[model samples]
Target: MADTRERDIIHAFVELSNELVDGYDIVDLLSGWTTNCAQLLDVAAAGLLLADGRDVLHVVAASSERTHDLEVFQLQRHQGPCLDCFNTGVAVNVPNLEVEAHRWPDFVRIARSKGFASVHAVPMRLQGTTLGAFGLFGDTPGSLNEDDLALAQALIHVASVAIINERAASDRDVINAQLQHALTGRIVLEQAKGVLANEGNLEMQDAFAVLRRYARDHQRKLTVLADQVVNREVSGQEILRHARFTSIRP
Candidate 1:
């Protein structure tokens, strides 16, 4: 089992590294990191909290539905291991939640209620600056073994490097701002696709094509137009009405 787990982690690294250079989606990359951590590590769940360029942390992804709820609760309370990790630019290893009750009462309470008894937070850092934290949660109250902790740190380091490298290549002024916008754009695009698919009775591919056409016709940024669609400022029917399809020649 240990060998298989190690192989899986290696495979995940290879997959992630392939997208590190260009045209990589930050939201997708971080989301995949959380999912992979939960699967490759012995953790019951995982989540990622990213600080925008201004050092404002946001819950970017969760490994599962319940994990999402716990992460959301942490964000709402503004106190948790991930927050500490990001703020201090160091790992916060909480082997037992019950012991940390006094320091993070709200976080402990909510985490316990959600069936999480332990958490390990690894900082996503480059040089002296930290961009985010990856959270590993377990249902049992015990610390991860040395090997597991080391593996988690390695994965976190790779992810942070990929993100920083992407930011350095962009024209953006700050890492957090750039990452936040990229993540938000992904969310908006997904929402717009769903709206179009349901309203126009179209497949996901068709809905995306319609969205692209509308953005081009209006000379609007695709991400901005997607946000408008999600906000209902632009309707799905409006995009469907303007989309033009062409046949491909064999």
Candidate 2:
């Protein structure tokens, strides 16, 4: 009976595998995974967790309000099957929450209170780098069958690819912007240094020090003052003398 049910779930998981292309919506993709798993596998609920660029656990998508609550519940407790899978790079298959070493005491207490009798987590990772976990909760107490575990594991692999791909794309955008930002700041700083040196008859390095100090002291970005000086919009008397180089007050 379980085998037949698991096959249906596995087939849908395989069907969803084709949709894991780049640029696919992260929320929608994972939500679909949760929905399909629940319906086909007889699970109570499911969710996928992913680490953001800053490595914070974010519940990207959920199947239901209870699933949403459960994800938050896991994060808040910080000691659950999902965390184990994420940290250890191993799957956690707690078939019966009531009978065990209670590896996830906090998690089990809450899940049991909510009427869930079992839980499972599969890591979304390759070998070294784990991006997150694929979590499952069930109403009846008994470990997920071998077939169900296989299906979930397969689904987890596909989810990892999609997640890693998305994270890479997001990271690329950030890196490119940061490079552009740094390059622009350097150009402006260099231009400001020249203006300060020319006006003060001081060495280029000293001019930079003064600019740096003043910008830091004022808690303002150096680019703003640098732009003004470059455009001849401000004087350099204080700049030449290394006095507090203030911008032209309108």
By TM-score, the best candidate is 1
TM-score of each: 0.73, 0.58
The candidate maximizing lDDT is 1
Global local distance difference test of model 2: 0.66
Model 2, runs deviating above 4 Å: 1-18, 21-23, 100-102, 166-250
Per-model root-mean-square deviation over C-alphas? 7.3, 18.8
Residue 195 of model 2 has an lDDT of 84
lDDT of each: 0.77, 0.66
Instruction: In model 2, state the lDDT of residue 121.
Output: 84
TM-score for model 1?
Answer: 0.73
Task: Give candidate 1's whole-model lDDT.
Answer: 0.77
